[model samples]
Target: MAENMFLFWGSGSIPCWKPMIVLEEKGFGGYKNKFITFSNKEHKGEDVLKLNPRGQVPTFKDGDIVVNESNAICEYLECTYKDKGTQLIPTDKAKRARVLQRMHEAAANMQQKLVLDLLYYFFQTKEEDRKEEEVAKKVEAAIEELDRWEAYLGETKAFVAGPDFSMADVWFYPIIAQSIRMGLDLGKFPNMKAYYDKVTARPSVQKSWPPHWKEEPPMISPFKGRI
Candidate 1:
């Protein structure tokens, strides 16, 4: 019997969405999912704060073991469930090194540059908000990074890790999807545009995306007036 697993998540957070995608790929459908509402400050409540002192969403509980941090949760899932299907982290030294390198890059570099910047522009509505000029610079920098990813895709096969959809791709696809939702023109990077369409079409990707997401307006950038 599978252990009772649960995930505490927030609906609008890309970090939470990352693990949701991984769980779908792992083919574990019987686990429970509980939403921690950001609007209500539910994540800061005692129960959630115990699991993650930072009170962030995307926390996981497997039986008695608790894990926080999106990337760490992904690594745990892949290791604990190694007998299940594909190994998310390759055992080969060279491939595994590349995988770890890329995963860190995506989380540290691309995510902050693209996803967080767009989040501020689209979600935060404070009057003291920073000027659009700063936002544009960040967006442009993110675009340059996307071009680098496109170049990598052109040189590789299969997915980000080559020949298989590993955790790197799992980590990557959601950020890209969020970028699309924020109205970034993916078409500017033809390879990435194609890759985006390809990943979202996967059965796992389809399963993880919330129903409300479908009804929301397609991500468009107010900067460009179109995504």
Candidate 2:
């Protein structure tokens, strides 16, 4: 059996979903999950803060090692579990460089934009408190970056970095899925819409999304498949 693993996560959070998707894709078994509640300030509590000083969701514990940062968690899984399943970060130097680049872009750029938009619009403390103009600007920037992703897809096949699904896709999928949930219409970008549909249909994604999330109608649907 695999070593005992624990993941600290919040329901429907993109960062949390990244590692969860990686774990499912790696087919690692025997892991435990602790669901943190943002509403209750569980993430900011002492116990979780000890593991993640930033007080972020998706902290990971494996044996004596505790890791925070979603990308770092995913990278650790790839290296530690390299022999367990399909290689996520490519072995080739150039290919791996491209994969890592895309992963960073998705994390630093795309996810940031989506998070800002969601914070301003859906999760704002008051209806009037929502930053309508700022949200629109951020959404436009996000769409521009998403257009680059679509172009990247057009140049490649099957996955983001290359022919096979890699960590880049894992990083990208959850952000897009959550963005869709926040009412970003995918119809404006057909390629991205198609790519989003393809990723959400994966069994790994289906498993990563919380059960409660399934009850809500998808805010955006680029394909017939339910996410």
At residue 142, candidate 2 shows an lDDT of 67
Model 2 lDDT on a 0 to 1 scale: 0.77
Instruction: Output candidate 1 Cα RMSD.
Output: 2.5
Best by lDDT: 2
Off by over 4 Å in 2: 1-3, 117-122, 129-132, 216-227
Query: Per-residue lDDT for 90-124 in model 2, tens only?
Result: 88999999999988888788767666544344454
Query: Candidate 1 regions off by >4 Å?
Result: 1-3, 125-130, 218-227
Error of 2 at 68 (Å): 1.7
Instruction: Give the clash count for each candidate.
Output: 2, 0
